[model samples]
Every structure is written in structure tokens, then in C-alpha cells.
Target: MDQTTAIIDLDLPGPRISRHVYGHFAEHLGRCIYGGFFVGEDSDVPNERGIRTDVVEALRALSIPNLRWPGGCFADDYHWRDGIGPRDQRPRMVNSHWGDVVEDNSFGTHEFMDLCELLGTDAYISGNVGSGSVAEMSEWIEYLTRADDSPMADLRRRNGRDEPWKVPFFGIGNEAWGCGGNLRVEQFASLARQYSTYVRNHAGNEVYRIAAGASDADLHWTEVLMQSFDALDRAEEADAPAGPFQAVSLHYYTMTGPWADKGSATEFSEDEWYLALERAGYMDQLLTRHGQVMDRYDPHRRVGLVVDEWGTWWNVEPGTNPGFLYQQNTLRDALVASVHLDAFHRHAERVVMANIAQTVNVLQAMLLTDPESGALVRTPSYHVFEMNTGHHDADSLDVHLQGVPTRTGEKSELPLVSASASTRGGTALVSLTNLDAQAGRTVVLDLRGRDVVGHSARVLSAPGLATHNTPEAPDAVAPVTLDAVRPHDRGLEVTLPAHSYVTVSLTLA
Candidate 1:
């Protein structure tokens, strides 16, 4: 591949990238909650109320903005009462969604909220809407956010906490058209309006309620949901105001093949590797199409599109529970993260927040959990997040790339050089990713209105897509400080390697 050119105008600005765009998702699937994050105090792992202390510190290091919890499909079956109160008294139940494994109900609402406080991240709770009554869902909200003298509030007090925990974002259900209830699109929309009505927004917590949108290219489902939003918004004119719907959420997962055989996480051919990248690049298209639908109803773009569930979904690691969805992360996963995140940065106006599926010890997790010895190792995906921290809350700058090649027809066309820029104060970050797995390209980064007096660069690249991190070899695929970065007269010239992601910071004079 020939060297490319990327031009950036530092003064050009776009919407502020929400910190929540870098949010994470932690579900009850497999060991994601049980052993992955919550290791009882008796174990060798450091813990506070069964939450692993090391994991907490790791998350804090990333300054993770928000965390969604309890379920993918498990949320629909989650009984809030069963998980509250004393751990010993909390009833056990079968997971029913992930595996037929027993759920000891040890980690509940209080523990989850406490974990959120420990990591200093906001909580995004998913309520049960499938096979559960409306009052059941409403009462759970009261237990978490209501400080009033209601019965639910009293129950929360008796359970232990005097003050209510804040819930900034809430999802009414997981996948209402599938595991959530298997209802039709219109039926889910009708049910979403009814269920969302009872979700209370108490003091100190406005509750950014997110309605579940369609899967991948299911534009009809989003249209139906928006139609419901229109009706709800119009009710205010009639003096019968309805609840607020701040955002609509869509879920997409990158799959190299069919669900039954989603190729190996650690071992795959170059074709499959490119296929994974191709699947990932489709996130941009999905957001663009979904954003267009949202604009039809929300022309002013008031409502946000939250990609609450995303990341590569692959076959479980061999010998693990098939339903657990546990997989390893490689340099390939890191590239996928950069690709999706760059998309979010470009569409900062419509795409507000996105939570990568399973923050730890599940599919595309940041940390791989060794259940036997209670050891944790950071995955390549974690390094991607750490490198991208500069994008949080920064104003986007206009970036243009030319002479870029493309990989056509796997799922979508992927450019060889993907880039995004953001500015904060006197500091500006220029990030670029080279999608070519076998060829390197030198990028002529053209800059205007900014002088790169000093700079630093961090890059994540590996020998091949099969390279990954394990407990024995944690640093096998970590970021290295690149010394090739230097400031030039025609802008900052940089060269990106095959299948690499680099972020350069320009400290203005």
C-alpha cells in the first residue's frame, strides 16, 4: 500500500465527545460478575464486599465514565428483591439465559452500586420488562432512586441504605424483539412506552431513559420506536405530558462467521482477520443509517443514539462453558475498538454513548480472568481504551485522509487509514489506524492553525492477528512508546504500520 495523506484543521470544531462514549458493559453472564469481578474476600484476590480490588483500580485507571450492568438477557429475568438484603438470604436461581448454571444471588443491587462507587463510574441499570409486571419494574426504580416515604423506599431503608443511589441511565429491556420477550416491533414499541412510563426520575437522578432499538440494519424497528417517541412528545401539547425518552439504543456485534461457528478468538487465518475488521467497520454505516432515521423524527438531533451493546462476538475459549461467551482478545480486537471508536468520534452529535460488551472475563473483555488462581491479565482491548482516553470530552477537529486504499466486500469497505482528531485547551490529539495487515503506510499528517512544539506517541501493534495476552505472558501484545514521531513543517508526518493503532499528542507552543 502506498503512503497516504491525512490533513487536519485544528480550529474546526464539532460536538463535544461524551465521556460516556467510552462506557463499558458488565453483565451477569458466565464469570463476568461472579468470579470475573466479584471474588469473595476469602480468596487470594484483593476484594471489598466480594468485588475484586485490583479490577476496581484498573477501571479507575482508565477513568471509565459509565458501566451498564446485570444482563444481556439476564436483566429480563432478574428479580431485584431476590438480589437485595443479606447475601445468605438471597434466593438462588438458574441463569436461564447464559447457561443453566446456578445463580447464588450473592451480588445484588447494593453490591453493584457499591462497585460503581469504587470505580467512580456512573451506573446504567437494565430493568426487567419480559414476563415481569409493570409494577415490578417501577418498584425497582423506587428502590434505587426514590428517597420518599413510599413502601419501596421504606424497603430500601430496611435493607440497609438510607439514601437512594443515583441511576443516570436506564434501559427498559434487553432485546424485546428476541430474548427480551420475542414480541414484534410494534408490540415492543407499545410495551416500551407503557413500561417506560412507570420508571421514576427522583431528585439527583434525572434518569436518561433509553428505549431499546433494532438489531443491525433493522431500520423498521427504529422507525417504530421513533414513532412512539413522536406520540409521547406530542402529548405535552395536550397537557398530558409523558415521560422523557432521552436516547434510543441499538445493539450490534462483529461476527466473522455464523453464530454456530464464530471462528476462533486466538487462531484465525488472514482472511478471517480481515473479515473481523470488515464486520467492525460496519458500525459506522449502522450509525449513519440509524441516525438518518432518528433525524426524520428528531431533525434537531435532540435524541441520542446509544450503542449500548457492541464488540466482537466469537466462540468461547475451548473447554469453557459454551454459553459463557468467553473469548480471548488479540491485536485484532484492539483494531476493532479503534475503528468503532473513531466512528463514534466522527458522529459525536448523534452517537452519544457506547458500551463495549463485557468489561471483564467475557466476550471481548478488557481483562481475562483466570478462575483457578484468581489472577487477572490486561488484554489488548484494554490498551486500546487506555490509548483513547484523550478522546473523552474533547472537541472534535476536522481530519481528512487521501490516497487511502480499501478492502471491499466482506461486510463493508474498510479504508487503509482511519483517523480522528480532538482538541482540549492547548493540547490536540491525532489518532490514526492502518488497516493493512501486511503493509505499512507513511501518513503525511497536514495540520493548520497549530504548531507542534512538542509531542509524544503511543502505539499498539503485534506480529500477527493470532498474538494475544494470557496469564503467563501478559505483555505479549502491549503498547510501546514510539520514537518515530517528529514534528515537520508541512504538519506532523507519521507512518502507521501494518494492523497498527497510534495516537499522537501535539503540545502547542
Candidate 2:
């Protein structure tokens, strides 16, 4: 076993790791919407007003803070009106982006809000800018949030909901550099400023407007957005229509292979494992670099950085529609999630929110639903989320590592371990991941500034990298109570298995 030591100074707590950092994304692609999260009320699957009941029950365990809706690329094409009135009379449109299948507009604005309520999560609406107008985007907000007797509110009443819903986060556009219109940074920044002007706050519901930002390593996009923001005269615009955008978004996905031939999700060699970890670890550099540019414009870190889209994107499973982006989740994917989330926790001050690429039946998904049998399977990534729930809304405690092992990949190097720590009222949660595929790790917790009285841990591991859960054996990669944790003179000592993730709950004295 490899040995390492990490120290956490409870007196030196950093920023509050926003629960929003643990958010999820659900787009109108593949089984994600139609068969994964929603099956019609008439279907055999148990549902609440067409929203999947079993799926909600499972996700609720994670205390899901927020959910991003409408699109990734689909948001720019979605027209909220088409989904409102009557479902049977709704227009049918080609998804175009995902599988070229017809979107019956069955799961529209109302259904989405219903899903959020069922999951007890905040709503994050990504508006259309590629193919939509400012008036359309403005009125959609009014229709969902204006509680008074207005044209849009009255239309909403006629559509059945008398009271408006709450929309907390709003995205101006999604990926304008690509599917969201293929626009230049200057053009999108100007559009973001203009369109965001009309996304009004209604009935005291304040929407955190997030402008579409760069993909991987595009620091120029961040520069342009901050430059545009620097031009705004906030002092004079104190109570402006829709206050200046509160945040800018970034999208980064970890892929083991190149885009044209992204490798398999479950089938991979040992070398591929270290490559994925190295790629995932690159998010730290992306956050730090972009944050430096933003700091030059806004030194106080007032504006937030939202990683609205991120996860591992792999090739579609065999016989699956390529456009749908359906892939299997395994131990490797779970570790990828841990790496990204640990990065998010470390940069909590600047990264205000993050949404994994998807929540169900899509890339790096949490749950997979069987279209034919209506069976629900929880992915290993789901267990990671559930296990890390203790970190939500908790103050981040920096972990100082010493003598950590490293593995060199084909193009990059990766530390064999990744970790983050946080504390709530009287308890502290230490999350650790061992990236080595064939070596166990003995980690010593050098607790400082706080006395640890008791500790218990659970480990999420599998016999191999490809271990995953199917409906036949749902607990294939589930967490088990770790029996190797013991109390040391300074704090706790944990024995982590190879290619495993562990969370230790400590009772602070």
C-alpha cells in the first residue's frame, strides 16, 4: 500500500461550497426526457402528472439543489410557447440535434416545473437565443413568474396554472460558439447583454442570469465576456430592469480519447484509466486560468462562474443512436465525477454553481431507464452524489497533501489520489479517491485546530474498472461500510482500496 498524509485546519475554513455546485442537467435528448424522467400519465410506469415517480424518489435522496432544463444545444431551439397549452394539440418538431427524432412537445414548461417540484430542486431555465426573440424570452419569464394580472400571466392562467412558478437561474444562451448559433465572442457578449436586459424579475423572484461562455481551454471567450462586463455602468443601473448578469458559464467534458473516436465508457485498458483522471484533473487549470482573467476585470469576485455543463462524454453504446449520446456508467465514470466535484469544492469561492452534463439516460448519467421494460437502474455516479451530500452548503476545509504518489499518462501526469474536505455544524466530511488501479492507499488525517472524537466511513469500489449496475443487479457498485478506518493519535487513519472512493464522517470535538 502507498502512504500519504493530509492536513485539514478546521480554523481555516474557506468559502461555503454552494449546494448549487452539486446541481444536475437534463436536456431534451434521447431517453433523458421522454423515457427516462417522464413517461406519460397513461403509461404503466408510476408517475406524478407524467413525471417519473421512481426516478424522483431516487434522486431526492441526493438532496438535489438545482436542475438545469430545456437545452444544452436544445435550449437555443426550444420555444416555451410550443410546450404550454394543450399537449395533444402541441406542435411536433424534429429534434434535429439528438437522433433526428420528433419532439412531440409533450414535456413542456409546465411539465418541467412539475418535475422540479417533485424533485424539490430549484429551476434553471436556459432560454433560446439562436432561434428565438427577446420578446419571446422576456414573456416566458413573465409567464412563469409574474403573479399579477398581465397578458402573459393571464395566458398562463388560461393554460391552467393560476400562480406563477419561481425561476432562480436563467441562461442567456448555450454554446453560441457552436450549435447555439456559431457566433463570435463579440457578438454573443453583445447579445447576452441585450437579451439579459429583458429577463425581468417578477413577483420578487430574482433570476441569476448566466451568459453562455467558452468550451475547454478557450480563455479568449472568458476575456471577451469580462471585457463586455467591464463596460457596464453598474452604479447608475442600480435598479435596472433585469440586473446585470450575475454569472458566466463554462463547459468542459473529460474524454479518454479524441472527439472523433471518444473511447468506450465501460470497455477500456489500464492506461485509459490514468488518461481519464489526467483529463479530469485539467479542470483545475481551466478554472484557475479563467478566474484570473475575471479577476483582472472584477477584483472582488462579485461575479460568479457557473460550470453549467460538464462530465465525461464517451462514444455511444453499440446499437444506440449516436446523436442521443447514451453511454454506460462504470467505476471509471464515478471517479471522473469525484475528480470534477473535488475541483469544484476547491474553487468554491469563484465557481458558484455546476451542473453535470445530465441526470438520466445520457452521458455520465445518474440513472438509466429501460424503455422497453420501464426498469430504473442507478449508476455508480449516483452513489457518488449520494455519498458526498454531506459537503453541500458546508464550509470548505483545505487539504494539504504531502508525498502523494503520481502516475504519468500518455500526454499528462495524474496524482494517484484526489480529495476535498468540508464541515457542517458539528461534523466534518472527508472525501478521498484512490486512482491507482492495483494499489491500496493508507491515508493519515493530520487533523489541526479541531479534535476528532469518532469517525466512520463507507467505500465505493468494485472488483474491476468495468463494474457497473444493471437492473438485474442494481447494487453492483454500491458503497459498503469500510472496516479499515481506525483512530490515530492526531486524527483518523483510513485504508482506501485501489480505484475506490471513500467518505469519512467525523465527529469533531
Each model's lDDT:
0.86, 0.92
Write candidate 2's Cα lDDT for 1-509 as tens digits: 66899989976789999999999999999889999889989989999898899999999999999999998999988999999898999998899999898999999999999999899999999999999999999999999999999999999999999989999999999999999999999999999998998999999999899999999889999998888775333545433432368799999999988889999998999988889889999999899999988887766677889999999999999999999999999999999999999999999989999999899999999999988788899999999999999999999999999879998776666899899999988899999999999999999998999877778899999999989999888899999999998878767789999999999999988
Off by over 4 Å in 2: 230-243
How many Å off is the CA of 271 in candidate 2? 0.3
Candidate 1 ranges beyond 4 A from true positions: 231-243
* lDDT against true structure, model 2: 0.92
Residue 192 deviation, candidate 1, in Å? 1.3
Per residue, candidate 1 scores C-alpha lDDT tens digits across 373-450 of 767899999998999888889999878888899877564677878889899988898889988889988888888876
Q: Which ten residues in a row have the lowest lDDT in candidate 1?
A: 233-242
Provide C-alpha RMSD values for all models, in order: 2.3, 1.9
Clashing pairs in 2: 71-75
